[model samples]
Target: MRAIVVERTGGPEVLAPADRADPVPGPGEVVIDVAAAGVNFIDIYHRSGHYKMPLPFTPGIEAAGTVTAVGPDVTGLSAGDLVASSDVRGAYAERAVIDADRAVPVPAALSAEDAAAAMLQGMTAHYLTHSTYAVQPGDTVLVHAAAGGMGLLLTQYVKLLGGRVIGTVSTPDKERLAREAGADEIVGYAGCAAAVRELTGGEGVPVVYDGVGKATFEDSLAALRRRGTLALYGAASGPVPPFDPARLAPSGSLFLTRPTLVHHIATREELTTRATDVLTRIARGELRLHIGRRYRLADARTAHEDLAGRRTTGKLLLLP
Candidate 1:
């Protein structure tokens, strides 16, 4: 099997392509021939050592493919099953193993690439809107990086829940993409807080979905209404520095939370529910997936560089 191996943690240059023996499933696990692996910010964090991992590991957690082997204690799945998982083990390879329970059945209406593209970011958007700070109808919410993969999903999900979205984008191209995804208003990073205030008639929004951490944390706080919530999910630019909790009091009793997808999908039932909703929506065209680019398995280094440099938009996938 061919895989991208990280023997050391540093820059994207450290992601080296190498040949490895095929993976075999362990108890309660299933092995799949990976068709596409989702390239995400989490993968970048793992490669850069921002998120610690054991040395000499493959650096992907989400992929979609056809099951070729099923291990002991696994049920309701068999060889030749089409599955995708957000919890794949060493997913940056031609073959990988994952727990059977973590695997989600991909709809026949969807392609393997789209399934891979949708899992992590799609479920994150689902939980952020439906669980973390449930958006009520008529509520106005702010979404940062509203042109990126997660941003587009958040914007569309908010609109589906009957809320208006005020999105922040860096470029005109991004602004157009955000608007196409149903963003009610698009503003540049500069003076975004003031723009949100003016757009909301000085009342601000009920919640701000911030994925671009550090760079946009203060603006996100400033754009919130009284008793609003700030769901800080990702740090695309960089991680935010530690701060005093008392800062929330002056921001009208604001709520700040840093949530992850693993907690929301801790149980197999919860994972299924969220994954099903996202995949079904995509299959029915209610949710649109933009696969910005695809690269060969050996080009994982380039993929990481492009993503970390913010040189691409939408979902990026590595095809093996």
Candidate 2:
């Protein structure tokens, strides 16, 4: 089997293609023939050592494919079953192993590429809107990087919950994409807080979903209504610099949280529910997945380069 191995942490050049032995399932695990693997920022974090992983490992967390082998103690799943999974590692290869319980059945209406695209980002968006803030009807919210992969999903889900979306993007093209995804208002990075305030009639939004981290953390606080919540989920630009808690007091007495998808889906049941909800929505067309780019497994380096350069939008996938 072919895989992209991160021999050391540094730049995109570290993701070297190599031939390796095919994976086999262990007890309670299944080996899947990888059809499509989702390329996420988390993978970059790992490859760059921002989020540490042991040296010389495969660097993917989400994928969808047909089951080729099932291990002992795994029930209700067998070879030839179509499945998708998030929270699994080693997906940047022709075949990957995941615990059977962690894999969810993919609906016939969705293709493997779309299924792979929907799992990680979709579930993250799900927990953010449903659990983190629980957006209310008619409530206004701010979403940063609104044309990016997670941003697009977050915008759509916020709209589905009947909340008004105020999105921020880097360019006019992205602004248009965010608006098409249901953003009630769009603004660039500069003066974003003022824009949000103006859009909300100067009261500010009740919640701010910020993924751009260092680039917009302070502005995110400034754009929130009194007692509003700020869910800081990603550090796409860079990690936010440390600051005094005293700042939050004047920033509308705001509530702040740093969330990761793993903590939200810590249990098997939670994982199943979130994955099922996101995938079912995609299957039924309630959610639209934008696959911004696709690359061959051997071209993983180029994929990382484009992602790091901010040259792509929406979900990126690697085909095995």
Candidate 3:
């Protein structure tokens, strides 16, 4: 099997291609012949050492593929099954092994590319709208990075739940994309809070979904209505600095939470429920995925370069 390994975490240049013996399934595990791997910000964290992993590890955490081998003690799945999963490392390869319990069946209506693209980001958006803040009809919410992969999906899901979205983007092209995804108001980072205030008639929104941490944290706090929540999910712009909890009191008595997909999908049932909900919505044409770019397996370095440079939009993928 050919896989990209990071012997040392530093830059995208460290992702090197190498040949290794095919992975063998362990008890309660399944070996997948990876059809597509989803390139995400988490992968960048791993490669850059922001998220530490054991040395000489493969970086990806999400992918969709066909099961070629099923290990002992695994039930309700078999060879030749199509599956997709998040929170599994080693996805940046032609083959990878994962626990059977962590893999979910991919509906026939979705292609391999779509399944891989939708798993991590789709599930993240799912829990954000339905669990963390529970968006309601007539509720206005703010979403940062509104033109990126997660942003687009978050925008669509908020609309599906009957909420209006105020999206923040970095460019004119992104503003158009955010609007297409159902955002009611689109603004750049320079005046995002003022724009949100204007859109809400100075009342602000009920919740602010912020993934671009550090850079937008203060603005996110200012964009919320009294008693609103701030769901800080990611740090694409970089991790946020430590701060005093006392600040929340003056910011409209806002609620603040930092949620991760791993925590939300901790149980097998929860994982399946969220994954199923997102995938079924896609199958029914209620939600859509935008795959911005595709790269060959060996071009993993370039993929990371573009992602870290913020040179691409939507979901980026690697076809093995």
Best by lDDT: 1
Clashing pairs in 3: none
Q: Give residue 303's lDDT in candidate 1 (0 to 100).
A: 92
Q: What does candidate 2's lDDT look like per residue over 161-220, in tens digits?
A: 999888888888888888889998888898899988888889998888998899899899
Candidate 3 residue-wise lDDT, 52-75, digit = tens: 899999989999999999999999
Where model 2 places Cα greater than 4 Å from the true spot, the runs are none
In candidate 1, what are the lDDT values of residues 1-320, reduced to their tens digit? 89999999999999998999999889999999999999999999999999999999999999999999999999999999999999999989999999999999999999999999999999999999999999999999999989889999999999999999999888888888899999999998988999999999999998999989999999999999999999999999899999899999988999999999999999999999999999999999999988889999999999999988888889999999
Candidate 3 residues lying further than 4 Å off, grouped into runs, are: none
Ranking by lDDT, best first? 1, 3, 2
lDDT of 3 at 134: 96
List ranges where model 1 is wrong by over 4 Å: none
Q: In candidate 3, what residue range of length 10 has the lowest lDDT sum?
A: 183-192
Better of 2 and 3 by lDDT: 3
C-alpha lDDT (0 to 100) for residue 168 of candidate 1: 89
